[model samples]
Every structure is written in structure tokens, then in C-alpha cells.
Target: MPRLKAEDAERREAAGHGPDFLEALARGLAVLQAFGPERRQMTLAETARVVDLPRATVRRALHTLVTLGHVESDGRLFRLTPRVLRLASGYLGANGLSAILQPRCERLSAEVGAPCSAAVLDGGDIVFIAYGQPARLLNLTTMVGLRLPAFCTALGRVLLAGLPEAEMDAVLAQHPPFAVTPQTELDPLRIRKRIAKARSDGFALVDQEAEQGFRSLAVPLRRHDGRVVAALNIGMHSERGTATVLRDSYLPLLRAQATDLAPQLL
Candidate 1:
């Protein structure tokens, strides 16, 4: 086993306590997550810097991952392999929410003449679990596992509103809002108020906050126990008119779908 540096060990201990914490497993996962679209391939030294771990530690993790077929390496450069998708597949298969929602999302997208998606909050981001698009080309393309900022998207607002106040506050504190677009509200107080409004209104409408020329509306999807587990949203071009028109036209549809699917989820 490669020895973790003193500072790295201290940071890991602080982040994950208890004797049951497997430091090696945590380090491996961290190393895996360090790879992203922007960083498709990297050298051992580059990966070590990104993960803030010693080169030896990262090298061992990469070796293990390569042996397991989750990573590919060519002497000097390392990259994740398609086999890594099995990890995400396992979660989706076990949860089954994506499977149940995809067909409904497609139907909704066709009816609305726009894109429809379902997402769940993951850390400071919202991960799209299911998505559907109209036959016509749209500026935005969403797919399963696409991650977006939770502070700026209607889907994110609704999902964040579903969290308890304390939990929501903790998340906001941890990931203070950043500007995804000029329309995105960077003020934490205003963002909190927006989330609060979503909680009370049962739906959220965002105009051009997530992307230029794009607008979206979202509503919470609850489980059988009335606990919100995810959010459903529709995205369209900003030319669709003002926020009021979006709310009036799409809010009811979103709410209806959410309600219809609530009994099926859990």
C-alpha cells in the first residue's frame, strides 16, 4: 500500500471519520472522479495534482482501476474506460426511477414541443437521470448523468426547495451561488428566497439563468409518502415569451405528471 502524505491523511481523516472508513476505497473513488470531460486523459503526475494526493498513491489507485477494467492506461497517460459506466448503471438499475420516468418524459416532450427531463440533487449539482427531446433540433441537449448547477436551474430550485431548511442552508453555505449566466442570481439570500418561493408555490420558473436563450420550469416529484425525491422540468427557447406564460402553460402539466408518477416512485 502506498503511504498517504501527512497532510493528505489529515484531510481525509477530517472529511471522513470513524474507524470503519476505508481510506484506500475513498482515495480510489476520488481518483476516479478526478477524470471529467475536460480531462479525458492525464499523466500520473497530473492526476496526483488534481486529486491532491501523492504520485505513488494515485499511481497505485490507477493501477488497481486499470486491473479492474475501469481505467485504461498506456504507460504514461491514464483515462477512464467505458466499463466505469457500470457503476452508474448499477445505481440506476437498483433505483429504477430513470426507467420509469423516461417514457413519460418523452411523451411530455412531444406534447409540449420542447425538452423534458427529470433530475435529482447530487451534492452542489443536479444530475439528469432521464431526458426527452422533441423531434426538432433544440439549442440544449440533455442526457442521463448530465450535471448542472443547482443554484441556477429550475429543476435544481425545485429539488433544493424539497430539502429541509437546515439541509438546504448547509448546501448553500457549502456551495455559494456562482454565475452560470448573466441572469443567474449570485446573491445567496435571493437564491434562498427563490428556493423558499418554490417550496411555497410548488413550482419554479427560471428564465435564461442556466443557459443563454433558454428557459425552464420545474415541479417536484414526490414519492408515495409525499416526500419529494426528484424534479421534472421542461426547457425551451426564451422566445417562448415571459416567465408568466411559461408558468401558466407548463406548470399545470408538470404538476400533473409529477402527481401521476408519485404513486409509482419510492
Candidate 2:
């Protein structure tokens, strides 16, 4: 449809390309994002609908991307080329967090016989950046790119503990906590106390708080300056054990690993 181009043209014309803004580039990137992990390939109509762009605009963007070796297309289907991975690889390489933490997470997962991860705060949520797991069957599982509300999760609490008082309040205010489970805590005062404990105690553990039948323990991963940057967590089914058991048994090991890895992250 010609409408997508017209829509984009309207945005650019309104902005007058002010102060380094590039509407066409933004639209092309949006087209690329329409292909996610679950959506590996799309027909023209699928891409147009997913990106909410007009079909003609999507077609032009796809053609430009294909020529630049960022996208590939058959006569009827379009998909991202492997070249797109360069974007993620550059992030992983530049940060070096995944490279340094992933192997440690694997070892920790094997030792604890549970899933393990490292996550960073994003607004009112925590996003998993590195993940590892054992073979135990779980009712719920977390993976890289999984996002969970910060207040109800051990990972989130430990990360929130890193922030100063005003900043932490602002972070929490970004989203009103809603129930994922009956056990999820939404009270600001109670959450503030949990974060305080996580800061003084250096770890947080919760059972059936984020989700029913699941438990997690987390420790802060800090830089050499001792500023927390991410959280390291281990999660298991609630049937496995209680929060106290993990705190006494697995937490020492988790903290040790986090401490050992902190300097490497610098």
C-alpha cells in the first residue's frame, strides 16, 4: 500500500529532519524488529501487519535491507540474514558480561541443580542477559530476554538494592505492581524493607513470590567500585526446598561466585 510511505513521509515532513533525526532509518529498523526470535520469516503482508507499516513501505525497506545484506528474501517470504547477529555480537563483545558470566552460571547451575541467570534492571523490571540451567523439570522457566517485575523477584530486589533511595523510588514508580500470584508483594513499604535487607545482607531469596511453585535466590553482581550492576540468581521449583534452605546452602556459593567474577567484569 502507498499509505505506509505517505505515513512515514508525513512524520519526516512534520519534523523537518531536525537535529539529526532520521525518520526513514527509524522505520527501516522497525521493519527489522518485526522479525523476532519467534518470527524468523514473514511474507510481505505479515511484515507489514507486524510493523504496522503500509505494505509498499515495508517492501521498499526490505529491498534496501536485502541489498545491504541485512535481510534475505525468497519470491514470497522475507527473513533476516545472519548478518543481523552482528548487532548483538557487538553488544556482547563490547560489554564482555555474557562472555564472563555465562560459563560461571553454567557451573553454578550444575552445582545447584537448578536454573541460573544474570539480569539487569530495566525500568520496573529485570531482563535476563545470561542464562544457564540443569535438566530438572520446572513448572516455569526463565531465559535470556525474559522480563519480570522487580519488586516480587529476588533478582529484582537485589538489583533495586543497588540504587539510591530516590532513584529506587522512581524506578518502582514506573509500573504499578499487579498480582502475578497471591504471594506477590506490592506494598511500597514492604518492598522498601526487602530492598534494604538485600542491601545489608548482600542477597535476597523468595519463594512463590514472582510465580506460584517457584523459588529464587539472588546476589548482587557489582563492579570493582562496589556499585551493583546486575544480579545473579538461581531458581528452582518450590517443591525442591524452602527459601531458608537455599539461603543457607546455595547463597554462600552464589555470593562467592559473584565476588570472584566482579573484578573480571571491570
Candidate 3:
């Protein structure tokens, strides 16, 4: 197959997609993501290099972003402002799934005596929107806006398993491999095999990949139309339960809660 030119990809993507869907939104998001924890303030040249866009394009995007209040800049440096939070907040406020699933997640956590969370796929990471824990001690310290690599987390795998094969391939291709932990799978073939297993099993069990002692299991939450909107997960210490324990004991509870909450998602 031939690679698509930027203009061709944009045309194909826009033909049937929403009016708001466009390559410009993606490029703008890339610009915003260029400013992260380590590179909070970036010069125009640095932003262009990081986002892999032309300096002129990056500058115009930055100017537009600043005008929209999503970014702020001094004469020489640009950084994301708190106004960016409104974009995320708007998503949470608009999605009824978080509110509908929070109670079920809490109940599941109480029943399993572990921490339960709900996350939606945001680009290549899973974003936590709602969570409940037995105690704050066992928590992963993840907040509503925290992002984690999709390939290493159970919540991520479950969500990824629901995506179209081509889309999943494109996403994984971007970060072919990165070692988040010793147990992380960096091999594409192995990752594909695991995703296939998750697709067949209807759940994903990630063992100590995100952190040394952390293990998590997740099931996809589907909307009324049967589209997967998010994932629900229960995470615990490695010592707390074996992988077998997670599969045999906790998975059923998680599946039950997901089934119960599915009706509320749409």
C-alpha cells in the first residue's frame, strides 16, 4: 500500500467524519503535547523540533493557541497555561460515563478490597477519569488527568483491543517500544499476540508492567450501541494476588460491574 500524503489523509478523514475532525486539530494537539513535564517552557525552534512541524507552522499554531487561552508565552518562551484544564474538564463534564460508572467502580473496589479505576483512551495513553480505593495507601497516586502508556497498562490493552486493527497498528507503530519496567513488552509481535488474547478473552491482565509491584486487570465498558467507551480496572500490589488470582477471582467481579454499568454509558 502507498503512504498517504497529508492532504490526501485529511480529505479521506473528513469525507465522513464530523465537521470538527481535521488534520489541523491533530497538529494543534501535537503542538500542545510538545510541552510536557520536562519541557514546560519551549522556544519556537524547540517546539518545531519537538512537534516535527515547520517553524512557521508551529509559530502560527502557538499564536492561535495563545489567543484561545490554551497556551501562554513570554517574548521568547511558550508554555501551557491552566486554561488547558478547561479542555480536559469539559470532556469529563460532558461524558456521563464517569459519573454513572463511579458508583459501580466504588462498589467493585469495596467488594474486591482493591483499588478500582475507569479510564478512557486519550491518544496513545489511557486517561483516568474516575477511581475508588479501599485506602489511599494502595493507590497508584493517579489523578483524574494522569496519563499512562497504553501498551503497558491493563486498562489500555482492553481499550486498544476494541479499536479497529488498522487504527491500533498506527498507534502502536508510533512508539514501537519503550521499557516502562523490566516486564514491559517492547516487541511488536509479542504485543500483537497479547492484544489478540485480550480481544478473545474480553479482558486484559497486565502483570507488573507499569510498576515493579503493581498488577492490574481490566474489562471494557461498552455503550448501548456496543461501542467500547472506556475500561474499568482493579489494581493491586503483586503480593496481594497472583495473576491466577486476578483471573479466577477478580475478573468475574469486574466483568459483572462492567455489564451492570454498560446500560448507563450511552
Candidate 4:
């Protein structure tokens, strides 16, 4: 596949006429964007290739970012430093969606005696934004900001079901809906049918799809305008209950919390 180049050129052209827009600053941001969970450490040439810029240009940007303490290098590979987290901190800290949803997640967790989370679909994944868990629940391997596959996760299915049919088809086509577990729906048509069921039912119950021993129940979290902006879900240990118990017993609790969280999305 071609390297990710579409956004870099677009951002530069959009910045062309802005009086205060800095090309160096934009390139520096691009260099930072080149790094992610999969590419945490990259050499200058690799960064240049990923950002679709010349090696010298990326090197210069990396040097300036190193001076600013946003990036660090040990003479081989460059990696972002903790200072870069400040940029994300400002956005997540802003009073609104997360602030409102997290408390509801906490209350929902307490009421159900389990872990609960709210996530929004981004690209082919769902990024966790808010969470809550009971004390007795074992520590989880996941945290806020973690991204999970959209096709296999209950949260992702509920969010995907909210999209218009054409938009949903487009997304499924791009992503291929690859199976994450043996039970996952690998066929795009089958996955579309599953999403349709979720749309009609107003929720999704994924049974051992994302993981072997876990299942999930999820519902759409809508805005005041009745647009689903995110999904709220409960992860369960499959051994604890059957799918019928998961839906009939615990699904209502999730739906109720989802109702409370919907209006806050505005």
C-alpha cells in the first residue's frame, strides 16, 4: 500500500494563504503524526517516507522538535516525549463530552458491579474515551485512549450501526471487516447484516468475537439531536453467563445508562 500522503499535502495547501501559518510548524506536526502505536520508534529516513517529505526536511523538523523537548532521539531512532502528551491533555480535559460521560460510566459500573466504558468510532477502530469499573473487578489490560478493532467489538458494531447505509457500506468496504477471532464475521455481507440487526435492535451483543473468552453488550449513545456520537458497552467474562443472560439480564442496564448519556453528547 502507498504511504499515508493524502493529509500532508492537503494541510500544506490549506496553510498556504494563512498569514500566521508556519510551514515548519506544520511539518513538525506531520513528523509527530508519523509516530503511532505501531511505529513508536522510527529512523529519519523512515519518518521521511511515512510523512512523504524529503529526509533533510524531516531531519530539520525533528531537530527543531527535539530542541522544543517534544521529541527525543538517541542518535538512532526518534520517539515522542512526554511533553507531546500536553497537546492531547488540553483536548481531553476540555469540559464537555468525556467529563459528562465518565461520571455516568462510573455510576453504571457501580450499579452493575462490572467494568463499563464509552468509546467513539475512529477510522476502523473504536477509541475508548471514558471508563468505570467496580473495585472487585480485576484490573484490565486496557485504558482510555486504547483503540480496538471496530468490526469485532460490540462498541464498534453499535456505533457502525448508527451510520447511514451507504456510509456504512463504504466503511466496511475500506476496512474489509477482518475476523479477529474464530467467531468473528469475516464476510462483508454478513457483517453488514449483523450491523443491520444492531441498527434495528438499538444495540449489539458480540459473543466471543473480539476475544475467545469474552463477550460484550453495547448500545448507542446519541446526541440531543438523535445522532449517535459514541457507544456505551459492558465487557463480560463468557463463563459468568450465557448470551441470553448477557442480553436479557444486563442489556437493560446498559441501555438505561446510554439513555442518560445521549443528551450530554451535545
Candidate 5:
């Protein structure tokens, strides 16, 4: 596919500008996102290519990020530093859902002997804000601000299932499927069917989709106004539990947590 032109992207952003708009902030965020797994240590040219910004623009943004200690460059390669976590930490600290859901997730993890997490849908992915794990040795290293595909994760599916059908379709249309594992659903029709089932059942179960041998079950966390603002999930190895176990044992606990958390979210 052809790369998005820098001028075109700038034009699109200019069209959206308002009196209170911060275009510089938007461009900075775009630069940060450009340094993902594939393009981790980008030079100025590569950063511009990935972010669809002019090389000069990206150079300035990198300099600003470096000055702020959010990014570090070793002469040629540039990458984000741990200071970027501060930004996500500030957001999570200010958000009510993370505070309320943290204790509930811990309780659920203790009760179920599995890892539990609460995540919010962000664009085409889910971002885990709170998590708990009973087994300290379990190698699930995901932390707050880690992003994963929405189609393959139980939390993502639950969030997507809660959306209106039209909105769900729009999101799916934008994310043409990429296989993360053999069990990952790629067909749009099949994904729609799975989402429909989740909507009706009030939960979502994903097995070996995001990663090999990983299984998870999730329920939507609805607010007082009945809008699903997040998803609660318990993750474990598929060999450790069956779908029936998830439905019979974990589902009720997750539902109860979600019910208790609904009132606490703003």
C-alpha cells in the first residue's frame, strides 16, 4: 500500500482545527505511536515515514520528546524511555475506573486462581489499565498502556460486542484481520457472528487467539447509564481450564465485579 502523504495528513488535521485545538500535541502523539514493535529505533527519515510527517517536522518532535525525557536517542536510533509511563500513569490515576477496578480485579484473581484484568477500548485496540494475578510466576508481562488487537482478545471482543451494530461494523472495516495465531478470526462475517453471540450472551470467550495456548473470558463493564465503558477479563492457559469452566466458574465472579464497579465509574 502507498504511504499516506505528509501534506494530506496535515491538511486533514488543519480541517479539524478549532480555537482550543492543539495540533502540535496531536503530531507529537502520532510520532510516539510510530515507534511500535516493527519500527522501534527509528531515525528521522524512518520516523517521518511511519508518522506521515515531514522529516524536519519529525526531527523537531523527536528533539522535543528527548528534551522532555520521554524519548532517548543513541546517536542514530531513537526509542521511548520509561518516562513515557508517567504519562499513562497520570491518565490512569485521574480516571475513576482504574481505581475502582483494581481492587475488584485483585479479588477476582484471588477467587479464581487466574489472572484478571480490566481494559478500555482505545481505537483499534484494548489498553489494560488494571490487572491482578494469583500466580506470580505466570509469564504474562503485559502492563498498563500495552496495546493489543481488538479482534483477538476477550476484553476487546466484549467491548466491541457492547457497541451498536453499525459502530462495530465500522471498527471492523477499519481493521482488516491480521493473524496473530492459528485461532485468530480473520473473516469479517465470522467475526460478526462471534460478536453477535457475545452480545446475546453478555460475555466473550477467546481461546488461543491473541497468543498460543492463551485463553480468556470477558464481560462488559457497564456504567450507571448502561453504557459499557470497559471490559473485565480472566486470562489463563487453555490447558489449565475449559470453556465450560470459564462459563460456570469465572463468568459469575466477573459479572459480580462488573456490577459492583458500574456505579463507581464516571
Candidate 6:
């Protein structure tokens, strides 16, 4: 296949662009995002299938990304290069939210001897921007930049709860709940109720939904204007604590941290 020239690619991508929107850039980002933990590397055909774009289109995007050092291709398969992390690092640096929340998450993790994280809702997923883990080794590991479904995590629930009712309904409709585990809630009505409860109660507690044997408690990190910009959560094994124990013991701590950080989020 011939490499697509910049102008040619832009002309081809014009079909999806509006007056201000850059369709070519969006396609490039979509192609970059198609590679994930499950898909460390993929062939051109596989990439086309995953992104639902024509093989030629995906090839051009991959070729352009490779030229920019954001992706690497061995002529058959492609993978994201370390240079892509620059995008994440740049966002963290400019946004400053991760830097601000990192120390707080570490303190919370140390206090409870568990893993803690802060995440923001992006589309139907929650992206971890900051994370902390205790000194001791544990079976599970969570980290920054991890993305998980919104309907199944405490962090995600709290973040979603912060959205307006109509917006929340649309989001739920767009991404219907799926069962991550047997304990995961698949009912949209029940999930909405849980989100509503989080909005009213100022906290969310989820048990073994995202991962079996893991229970998490979360609270919304709000700005001075009372707008929730992120969610804070801590997770532990279900064997270590029941739902009531997690709620009673950890909810206050989470809420306290959220409150303390609210003023800084602005």
C-alpha cells in the first residue's frame, strides 16, 4: 500500500469533520487508543477491525503515527511507543490535578493500609489519574492511567453520580451495564438507584463488582463550586471487611480527603 500524504489523508478524513473539528486528528487518536492492555500489538487488519475503519485508512493513520514516533510498526503489526506516554505526562503536568491528588492518595492508602485512586469519568470509562498503594505486597495492583468501566466501580459510580440527571441517563443508555463479575450489577435501574444514592449520601460503596473479593468505597472530589471533577476511592479484600464495615470505617476518611481537596481542585 502507498503511504498517504498529509494532504491526501486530510482530504479523505474530511468526511467526518465539521467546521472546527479535525477528523484526521480524531482518527489518529482513535487508532492510538485502539491499542491497550489486552491488545499490546495488532496487525493492520486487526487494527482496522477494532477501530471499524477501512484497512487503507488505518494503515495511513498507523503510518503517520509511526513517522511521528507515537507508534511503531514492523510492516505487519503495530504497537504504541513510549512516546505516546508523553501525551499523558503532558496532561498531568498541565492539568496539575494528578500532582495535587497524588500525595493525598498516598496518605489515604497509608492510613488504611490499602490501595487508593483518583479517577475522572471519560466517556463510559473512568480513567485513573492518580493512585497509591501500601508498602506491603498485595495480590492486586492498581495504577495510574488504568481505565475501567464506569458502571462497575466505586470511583466510577461516584463520578457518574455527579453528572446531571438527563446527562446521566443518556450516558447509561449509551453504555449499558455489563456484568464484570457475578456480583456486578447489570440492571440499569438498580445502577441508577445506586448512583442516585451516591449523589444524596455523598459516597458510594461497591462490593466485588469490578473485581471479585475486592470492595471499594468512594466519594466525589468536588471543587469550590460544588461541581464534582473527580472521584476518590480505596479498595480492600472483601474477606478483610464487609460492606457495612467498609462504609462505616472508610467512608468518613474518604469524605474527609475529598472535602480537603475540594478547595484545591479549582
Give the whole-model CA lDDT for all candidates, comma-separated: 0.89, 0.86, 0.86, 0.84, 0.85, 0.88
* Residue-by-residue lDDT tens digits, candidate 2, 171-241: 88877778889998878888889889999999998879898999999999999998888899988787877
- Candidate ranking (TM-score, best to worst): 1, 6, 5, 4, 3, 2
Cα RMSD, model 6? 3.8
Report the number of the highest-TM-score candidate: 1
Please, what are the lDDT tens digits per residue for candidate 6 over residues 39-72? Answer: 9999999999999989998999999999999999
Candidate 2 Cα misplacement greater than 4 A, ranges: 1-18, 21-84, 135-142
- Tell me the tens digit of each residue's lDDT in model 4 across 1-266: 13434455566577674445566777788999889889999999999999998999999999998999999999989999989878866767983777887888888888887778988888888988888888797775546777888988899998999988788778777787666788987887788788889999999999999989898999998888989888898877888898888889778887777776665578
Clashing pairs in 5: none
Name the regions of candidate 4 deviating beyond 4 angstroms: 1-30, 46-54, 137-142
lDDT of 1 by residue, 18-68 (tens): 556677899999999999878999999999999998999998999999999
On a 0 to 100 scale, what is the lDDT of residue 171 in model 1?
A: 88
- Our model 5 lands, by Cα RMSD against the true structure, at 4.0
Runs of candidate 5 with Cα error greater than 4 angstroms are: 1-10, 13-23, 138-142
Report model 5's TM-score to 2 decimal places.
Answer: 0.89
RMSD of each: 2.5, 5.0, 4.9, 4.8, 4.0, 3.8
Task: Tell me the tens digit of each residue's lDDT in model 3 across 211-244.
Answer: 7898999999998888999999998888977988
Off by over 4 Å in 1: 1-13, 138-142
> Candidate 2: which pairs clash?
1-56
| Candidate 1: Cα lDDT at 201 | 94
